[model samples]
Target: MKGIVMEVYEDKVIVLAKDGSFLEVNRDNRDLDIGQEIEVDDNNKKIRGRIIKRLASIAAAFILLITTGYGVYGYYTPYGYINVDINPSVEIAYNLYNRVIDLKGLNEDGNILISKIKNYRNRTIENVINEVIDTAVEQAYVRPEQENVILITITEKKDKVDDEKIYKLVDSHIKQKIENTEVILIEGDNNIYKRAREDKISPGKLMLIEKAIDLNKDIKFEEVAKKPVKEIMRMIKEAKREKEKKEERKKLEKKTEKEMDKIEEMKFNKSRKAKGKKEDKLEREEIEKFRKDKTKKDEEEKEIEVDKIEKYKEKDQRRYLKKKSQDEFEEQRKEKQENLIINDNKKNQDNKYKVDKSEKKNKSKRGHENEYKHNKKERGKDED
Candidate 1:
């Protein structure tokens, strides 16, 4: 019969016939592949019951593999951790669903305490922690009459988890369950837990040791690790008070310095103002002195001008006097010459009058002599 190979096995091959029925045939040494057409003998055909049985076996194996993978993933993966320290240090590890997946003891006392508690399977983390504390109390690891300190450090591996809420819830629950016990809750991270594991101590104990060292630099990590939590808290308080006092002193000194600087600035401004006033006074004095000198010089120049004018007037007066004297002398000389000319004219007139009178008397004497001659001549003619 001709058929198409569907599955190949070591001893047999499953094939689909053209008639739409499945057949199981014994495999030969020849290479046969799935989906390849081939010829098989009708005698080699097996019953369909064997194919059903083989398919059922494969289905059962696949289901088992899936279930086992899920189981390992859920049980082995850690989501968060809680470190409980009370002298008996126990670290509990939980899965994503908040179920306790693992529990470990960090010390000998922790190991002993963990051995006493049984059946951690399927228990919630809160129940596991409460049981651990109750077991510790029963074992005399935590005493009620004395001072008991319980430190819980929580570290989360996922961001979606609310670490603060978990811390508050755990703190509130443990405080209610135990009486007269001091409970300290710390929210921690992966790095603190890793370092705690390396140091072979619980995370809560490691945190207290670190804080003690910060408060007192002289205290070594080994020394703090051996000390109790109460002593470390006391050292931190004292150191903080000292630091606050030093800061106050520094602030006071700064305030005093600022006041002194302000006073010096005011003094400098006052001195500068006084110097400016003195300079103004000197400038005014110099200006006044210059004005007085100018006025005195102008008066001296006026006096010199007045003296020059007086000298000019005196010279003109002398010249006028000399001209008047010369005019008077010329008038007197002209009057004297006119009087001399009048006297000479009067003398000449008088001489001329005396000569005329003499002439007239002579003429009369001549007339009488002539008349006597005529009379004598007539008397001589009469005698002849």
Candidate 2:
């Protein structure tokens, strides 16, 4: 079977022959899609499948060593001669496309539209040529999962994806593929002058981080949106900075509110003390007036007792009543006068104390208000 292959696990082995209708023989893996014959020891101890090995076999010589048709006949195939070098199957496909489409003629307007279409078809599969180059490279470094190199040629003039957008798209999608295989890219044009140099990329182990692009295919942004490592790390740093800033702002606001509350409490305390002092003053004043009225009434009673002494004509009665009046009036008046003086002094002391405390309280309250203002300014500065 020319194209028969059996895949075990992830490796594909070419099935080349059948022995005794039950056992099988196969060409050793070479990673190329083309088929060739190989010779092995009678007991399968020795296997030969390399390029030189194929030269010893007649069947391999027919496929790779000899050319008997109007196909590539030289190692130095020229710029316009790649299609001639391709395998017969691809050659037949190209001929069919040419016959069915007449891709080389011109119209009445002398426009070379057919020529352009032929060019398009040719460039569409240019990577088949690059595959040859990749195989040459892979000879030394046969990548795991078989990394592939494709050569693509673009037409001279036609519609294509935007170049910059294509770069961004491709760089994001091709990062995930078979292990150890990093696909290589190269592009050229009709004169076959290369436009873009080759890019060899390694696959990502975590998530697919390479950009993969498909020409003339529709794909979405998220499907290929892996940010470069540098970009992602930069974003993380920026997020941390923003979070720190927010936390600092909240602290500033909290400190400012705390200071404001302290100032408010000081103001309240100062006003409450001032109000209490006023009430105390009023109460003292009422006490003074009541004491004075009671003292005046007691003096009138003392004068009446003096008249009783004079009206008692007898010496004994006069002496006894005089003694009573003197003792009672003197003692009572002395006590009342002492009480009045003490109460007046107490009122004066209370007023003085209140005045001193009020001054200190007002000063303290003003200091608290100023402190709050300073704190507010500091908080604002911090936020800025």
Candidate 3:
């Protein structure tokens, strides 16, 4: 049956079928993504029944191919491949049923290790891997006292299986069976596997070499390709550490630069405030000086005005005294003149009175004589 992959998990894929039904199928190294179309076995039967049917079909195909004289070739045909690298490089091929079909050595140490394994064919892939590790341990290829690294790279001929399950099974088995060994698992495509084979190296080693070269561009592939897996991994680890340290240093430098910039800004603002204060002080001093000068000028003007008033008062007093003295002298001269006139007039009148008195006395004397003569004549006449 065909369906669209709706969701994918480590060991199962949720597929949406055309009949609007959902099916959960076991994922065995199948590289599936959401929305991709895939062929799945019918879900009507139980998973055990399906496996039995599949096995029956294989058996029938095997019998048919045996009658055709091509049974061994068809049974040994690989559906997936795994490359194990420790210093020794070994490759294992498995058929559709996940049974090991072949094993090959890529180097001298790998050849020696494989020669020690008595029987690997027709065994489960996990059992085959266990035996291979056991053989390597027996040959001292994997020493517990030293830093042992095993790099496993898996590549499928078709997208019908989940490599993650296989990697987990192998990882769990090796960890239980071995100690003090680092196991690295890699899931690769046909292109990378083919390229690694062409370069005469395992895919896991090639991947490490590529990563190392990316970290340090000065490293050459040929120079590092011949090195052991442990040494290449060590180089990769040191390079990563150096990269991290450099990043941290750059961050610290940036932080220091920012702090310095902040300090400089504060200093600039402080200096600006100080300069402003100095200008303010100078301005205040100028204002105070102007006030003092104005005060002094006003005092000097008042003193000059007072002196002018005093000088005017003195001139007025002198003029008043001179005028009074002149008036007094004129009055005294006029009084003396009046007194002399009165005295002259009195003298003249006194002289006139004396003359009149003398004349009057003479007249009186003549009149009395005349009266007496007349009386005497009258008396004589009477006597006669």
TM-scores for the candidates: 0.45, 0.18, 0.54
- Judging by TM-score against the true structure, name the best candidate: 3
Can you write out model 1's per-residue Cα lDDT over 205-305, one digit (the tens) per residue?
88888876676678787666655555555566677676677788889789889988998999987876777868778878989999999999999999999
Worst 10 residues of 2 by lDDT: 84-93
What is the lDDT for 287 in model 3? 100
Model 3: per-residue Cα lDDT over 176-198, one tens digit each: 75678888888888888889989
Runs in model 2 deviating more than 4 A are 1-24, 27-32, 36-65, 72-174, 178-187, 190-384
Q: State residue 232's C-alpha deviation in candidate 3, in Å.
A: 1.4
Question: What's model 3's lDDT at 173?
Answer: 65
Error of 3 at 325 (Å): 94
Q: State residue 75's C-alpha deviation in candidate 2, in Å.
A: 8.7
lDDT of each: 0.74, 0.39, 0.79
Candidate 2 colliding pairs, count: 14
